[model samples]
Target: MSSSDIFIGETIGTAILILLGGGVCAAVTLKASKARGAGWLAIALGWGFAVMTAVYISAPLSGAHLNPAVTVGLAIKDGDWSNVPVYFAGEFLGAMIGAALVWVAYYGQFRAHLTDEDVVGDLSARAADTKAVEAREKGAGPVLGVFSTGPEIRNPAQNLATEIVGTFVLIIAVLTQGLNDAGNGLGVLGGLITALVVVSIGLSLGGPTGYAINPARDLGPRIVHALLPLPNKGGSDWTYAWVPVVGPLIGGALAAGVYNLAFA
Candidate 1:
C-alpha cells in the first residue's frame, strides 16, 4: 500500500478508538439518566473491547496504534523509526478529533444533569444511589454521578502507583510479543494480554481514582469534559492529574529499562 494509505488508516483507527474507548467513559460518567455508577469495571471492559476491536480492524492496515505512547514504544523497541512520525501524527490528530466528537455524542447527557460546581460524583452518587438509579430508568432524567478516578484510588501516591503499575503491566506484555519470533502469534496474542491487564486493573485497582493509564485517554476526554455542558461539575481535579501521566511515562520507561537490561 501507499504511504498515504498507512497514514490515513492510522488517523481513522485512532479516531474511532478514542470515540469508542473514551466514548464509553463519558457514557458511564455523564449523568445520562440511563445508566449511572455503572462502575469502573464497565469502563475498563469498554476500553479493553475498544482496544481489541481497533486492533482487529486496523492491525493489518496501519497497525491500529491508537495511542502515541504505544507508537513510541514500538519505535523504541523495534527500530522502525521511519514509520514513527506517521503513526505519531495520526494518533495525536485522531485524539484531538475524537475528543471533539465525544463531546458532541454525549451532548445530551451533559446537558440534562444539574451542574453543581461542588458536585463530586463519587461521593454524591453513593449518598444518592437510590436516586441515581431511579433517574436512569426515567431516561433523560437525573442520575447520580459517581465520580471516581481511573486506576481508582484518590491519594496521589496511590494513584501514581496504580498508573505506574498498570502501565508497567501493559508495556511489558507488548514487549513480550515484540521479543518473540517474527511470524509468531504474538500479533493476536498481544491483544489478549492487554485485555487481561486492563480488566485486572479495573476490578482491583479501579476503586480509587479510576485508572487513566493512558495519558491521551484521560487528557483527551478530560478536554471534552471541559468543553461540554454539565451542571455543578467540580474542578478537573488537575492537582492529581499528573500521576497518570507521570506514572505511565515511568511505566513505559521501566518497560524500556527492562528491555534494555535484557540486551545488556
Candidate 2:
C-alpha cells in the first residue's frame, strides 16, 4: 500500500471500528435507548462485529491495522518502522471522529442520562461529599464508560496487568493466526476468526479495565470524551489513562518478542 492508501485505510477503518464499538456501549448504557441494559454480551458481540466489518472494508488498502498496538506489533514483527507514525495518526484521528459521531447519534440519550437526578445524583449533594468529588475526578464518571474503559476496582498495577494480558492474547492470535499469507493484513476468514477471539477475550478477560487491549481504541475516545461538551460529563480520569496506552503497547511488544523467539 502507498502512504496515502495506508493513511486513508486506517483512518476509515478505525473510525468504523470505534463507531460501532462505542455505539454498542452508548446503546446499552444510555437512558431512553431501546437497547439500554442490553448487557455485556451485547457489547462484546457488537465489538466483534465492528472488528470484522472494519477489517474487511479496509484490508485491501492498508491491511486494516486499526489499532495502534496492532500497528506496533506488526512493525516489530516485520522490523519495519517506516509507516508506524502514519498508522498512529490515522488511528487516533479516526477514533476521535467515531466517538464524536456516537455522541451525535445518541445525543438525546446522553442528555437524558446525564441530567437524570437518579443517575448523576443531586449535583449539589455530590459536591458536598468530598469523597464523591474526589472519586469523580480521579476515576470514571457515569457516562465516561461509553467512550473509554475504566477499572471496576481502582488498582493501577492490577488494571495495567489485565490490559497487558488481554492485549498479549490478542496480538499473539493476530500474529499467529489472523494475518494473511502476505503478512500484511487479515486473510479472507481471518477477520471473522479474529473477531471471535476478541469476543472470547472480552467474555473472559474483560472484567477488569474492560480489556482495552488497544491503545488507540482507548486513548482516542477518552480524549474525545474530555473534549466534548456532554452535560455533567465528569473527569476523563487522566490518572488512569496511561495504563491503557502503556499496557497495550507493552503487551504488543512482548507478544512480538515471544513470536520472534518461539514462532519465527
Candidate 3:
C-alpha cells in the first residue's frame, strides 16, 4: 500500500479501536441502564483486538506502530528515523478521530438520558463548579477519561512506589516481548501474558487506583472527556491525572534503565 493508503488505514483503525474501547466505558458510566458495565470484558478484549487488528491492517504497509510509546521505544532501540514523523502524527491524529467518533456515536443517548445534575456529579476535579458550567455549554461532562490511583494513598511516597512498580512491570514486558527483541518473543503467546498481567494487577494491586500505565490512553481520553459535551459531565480531575502520566513514564524509563544495566 502507498503512504497515503497507510495513513488512511491508520486513521480508520485507530478510530475503531477507541470507538470500541472508550465506547464500552461510556455505555455504562455515562448513562445508567441495565447493561451498565456489561462491556468491561469487552473493553479489555477489544483493546487487545484493536492492537492486533490495527497491526494486521497496517503491518504490510507501514508496520503499524499504532502507539506513541511503541514508536518511541522502537526509535530508541533500532534508530529507524525515516517514517518516524509520519507514524507519530498518524497515531496521534488517529487517536483523536477515534475518540471523537466515540463521542459522536454516543451523542444522542447522552442527551436523552443524562441531565445537568448527573454531569455535575461526575467531575474528577475539585474546581468542578466552574468546569461543570463550562461543560454545559459544550454538551459534555467529566470526560472520556481513565485514571489510576492507589486507594488509601494519602501518603505520597507509597503511592508513588505502587505506580513505579506497576509501570516497571509493564515497561519491562513491552521491552522484552515487544520492541526490544521481536524474534525470540512468545509471539501469539505474548498476548495472554499481558492479559494475565492486567488481570493480576486488577485483582491485586489495582485496588487503590486502576492501572493507568499508558499516558496517552488515559490523558488522551480525558481530554476528550472534557471537550465532548455530554449530560451530567463532571470535573476533569486534573489533580490525579498526572499519576498515570508520570508514573508510567517513570516506570517505562526505569524499566529501560534496569534492562540496559543488566543486559546491555
Worst window of 10 by summed lDDT in candidate 2: 132-141
Q: Model 2, which residues run further than 4 Å from truth? A: 127-135
Scored against the true structure, residue 116 in model 1 reaches a CA lDDT of 34
Cα RMSDs of all predictions?
A: 7.4, 1.4, 5.4
What range of 10 consecutive residues in model 3 has the weakest lDDT sum?
Answer: 178-187
Q: Give the alpha carbon lDDT tens digit for every residue of 128-173 in model 1.
A: 6866544433322232122213333356787787777777777766
lDDT by residue for model 2 (114-176), tens: 999999989999899998888876667789999999999999999999999999998989999
TM values, all candidates: 0.73, 0.96, 0.68
**Best-fitting candidate, measured by TM-score?**
2
Error of 1 at 121 (Å): 12
Off by over 4 Å in 3: 1-13, 32-34, 39-46, 62-64, 79-87, 116-163, 178-204
lDDT of 2 at 91: 90
Q: 1 or 2: which has the higher lDDT?
A: 2
Model 3 residue 254 CA deviation (Å) reads 2.1
Any idea what lDDT model 3 has? 0.55
